[model samples]
Target: MAEQFNFSSPPFDLLRAAERERLSEALSVGYYAAGETLIAAGSAVPCLFVVLKGVIEERGEDGKLFAQYTSDDIFDIRGLFSGSSKHVYCAVEESITYELPASVFHQLCGANPDFGRFFQADLAAKRQLARRDGQNLAEFILTRIAREHLLPAIEVSAGLALGDAARLQLSRGADALLVRQDGELGIVTRTDLMTAHFRDGRSEAEPIGPLAHGPLACVELGDFLFDAMILMTRKRIERVAVREDGEVVGLLHLTQVLSLFSTHSHVLAMRIARAESEEELRGAAETLHTLIATLCGNGIRLRFIMQLVSALNEQLLERLFELLVPPALRSRCCLLVMGSEGRGEQLLKTDQDNALILAEDLPVEQGLALMQRFSEALLSFGYPPCPGGVMASQPAWCKPLAAWQRELNQTQLEGQPEQLMRMSILADASPVAGNRQLYEGLRQGLLRFAQEGERWLPDMAAAALQFDTPLTILGNLKTREEHLDIKRGGIFPLVHGCRVLALREGLEERGTLARLGALKARGVLDEGLADNLAESFELFLQLRLQQQLGGARDGREHGLDVARLSRHERDLLRFGLHAVKKFKQSLAWQFHLESR
Candidate 1:
């Protein structure tokens, strides 16, 4: 019997030698006839059921089929801890199942903490575990360059004597050292050092400036480890600088990549970071959907995928800004990305939401050419234009820092409904390049104004409840026009609700998940609600991304294509919407919008 049962299967496989022996000895096989209820609603869950044959159907009290378990699929583990089942589990056909008694299952869970957490973990954790369910090695999608060890970057002033630079490089024990001049970054390698003296015949006392290579090749820290190897091979360079937030932070050597992975060229971040021209950046941006599909298909979690995409987008936008904006004006203004892009939740190349902030009283004439080209370049890259005119090209969004602060303060103080929409959009603004200090000063002032405004929160929060959820009377999803507009129903309410709560509590975080965590930490929200909201938010992102990628090539708008989803998917969608409804209800109570 021990040999017949798949001890190698998950959950069972997680059991060790002693635990396996205990499980094998205690395991018993049971049979159920078709149409017979295995577990009744509200009944105490008896034991774990791992199907050996036939199908099992799980239905709610309304008799709506929520799921079907067949083959090796397990049913209702959470029912044990909760002590009662909320759904009826009935055999769809005659079945044979491996039953592990409640006591033995509990013992195994206690013995293996990893196995325990698999059931107790949050939705994200469960997704990760499920991705690794039967696997030995982690999925390739999780192999990020940032997780790999990066060699520290050594830097020397451009005017440093060749001998001094060489000594500095040697002291740091690096193959190369970075050189900075006039806000430009370049690299001077040890081999280049020898080439300078021997090939160019320059004295050791000469400055290393002329020997430095301009526009050094780069890859962002969030890039795939697999892509980094491809970049090294294609460029024929031994290493590439790693960028974070538009700044070079470390080095990724070919030797390091060689030890980790072989060549594969789906390198969006690497291509964007190493791009020399606007055309090159455009080519890189075109591959964004392919990369998203690859990562999502490989079982990478949605939030992690969003983080990687956001970092890559930032690197691309920063390089594009450097190309169009003149050197003289670069330090006097800050380039911003707002809305979904700023929130770090954007999964696909959507509408352009951006703005610019100039230093106080600084002339915009120096970079006026920049304002339109930035938007045009993005449009050329397949990013749709913001119909609401939220882009930097709009004069209303592009303003001086003092002007921005004053407008934000006036909006908050006046408490106008029309103005609150602008306030909400800016709540998630983030600076990706130029002098970030300009944006920082503007943001700090905005937060101060919101904190003091008495009616700001309720008015803003009231907007979250304006759209009713797309759930039926029995808490099932109700679709409109053959599909559900998940954005209006689930995504917006969760995002804006979390934003208002975060602001009311004075949290500076921008991402919804980050805000939810902060709110929980500050005791504004309980752990259960926080986890539920986070899980639900991620679920919406995953669903939205799934449909977006499916329609990318066809240029169709994205949503949960209700007519095409599987029963399990539909149930998951319902579960996620319920969580969203719960969150919105809480917001209504907290912000005193219950009457409205």
Candidate 2:
């Protein structure tokens, strides 16, 4: 017998050791000459094939290659279950393959439910399985809040004296106390009592009710630890009241959430929030890469990681702005992060694509000087300057709100490609620091322009379909110089198409996935198509990240070498690109851009 092949990847990796051993013993080895047909179209798949030391090409009826399976690749799961094949598998080179008889394969599947589901499930289910595997490795973050030992919620009457409330909280070793007033509940933290007692020079005999804040941020006990972390991040609060069935159960603090993971996002967030100088923030920013690497290595979902990182990045940028700009001037300007950073999809620190929206009366020159210094500071903090000069340092991007509205009006009228692209970029703009109202005013103007400029929608959507999807008519990846531009072919179509739809629907979501959901909710997109687009977009992002991590040069658009990707990854890329093609077709139909 030939040596047993290792089943260490997904679908196969789900098999139990005993089952694998049994299948391994039943496996036989076979050799094929180059060009030999292993599995003919329409023929019953006799055995599950695992490429041992050769390459197998799966060709369609027209003899066009659809996929290639190299060493360690498994094939024919769908065919085996269906009892027939739609395509013929031929050896691309003289090859050896491990053959597991269909009978034994069935037996192994029957014995292991997980193994069966892995092979029989759809792509979405398989993705869920993969996520489960990742979650298993990082289960601490996924732990339910109810599972942790929680402090009892110390209760105090509404009219209790400050001194008595303080004594009760301290004596109970409680960090927070719940106060009942007018049949409503409020929370007073130890910090609140101390501030009222010492900082304000308040009499200890005064009632504590004034110190308690009503309508507190609270989370259900069933929420995951990660949910609590997000709540804390967004609310800018250190603690939240944990509720169980509408009753206060305990208090969850930021430190408690941080204790669950070693990534130290909580610590980084604190450092960014507390840093008063550029050097301190820079030190904190330097550790971000290590944290990202750790999270990625642990198989944490890229989406969750991106959210946490985006929040932390926003904090850093906000702190930097505060340090560089005067409080009075900062209040008059709105700092906006455009493009990927604004969309919260940035996995790596790219360039700074930012703008500043100044109040109508502010001096443009003064704003420009402050922005120039801010952009330079970002470069020192590791963000490269935008190659297209989209940063706030550019005088044009640092314009007053009225100037921005005029620019939008002019762009809508001109409809020039460059101007339209700029408009599209700004459509994703999100306020990072300074006066959010200024950004909101500018955004409302853009939305109104988008709504009234119906003719511009097609032109904006046309960019999405400009590049041909990197798939050939023969069902093969179309490549130039043996590389595929994943962004142009897959990412942009979904992103820009969704942006156009979001604009039409008046949705404020900046992220592509979130926009898809909003579109689905607004009935602008079918649920199935939305789900497919979301998965496809995620696939593209994952592939791009993988390509970048594989040592692609920074500061330039990167491409993926199809030959270098694993068979599974190649299949996913093909599926994602096909989704992009469908998305483009839909866009053309909706926008009437097909004739163009």
Whole-model lDDT per candidate = 0.78, 0.82
lDDT of 1 by residue, 83-140 (tens): 8899999998999888888888888888888777766765555544434422211244
Name the 10 consecutive residues with the lowest summed lDDT in model 2: 549-558
TM agreement with the true structure for every prediction: 0.70, 0.91
- Cα displacement (Å) at residue 426, model 2: 1.2
In model 1, where is the ten-residue run with the lowest total lDDT? 130-139
lDDT of 1 at 177: 87
Best by TM-score: 2
Q: List the residue pairs that clash in candidate 1.
A: none
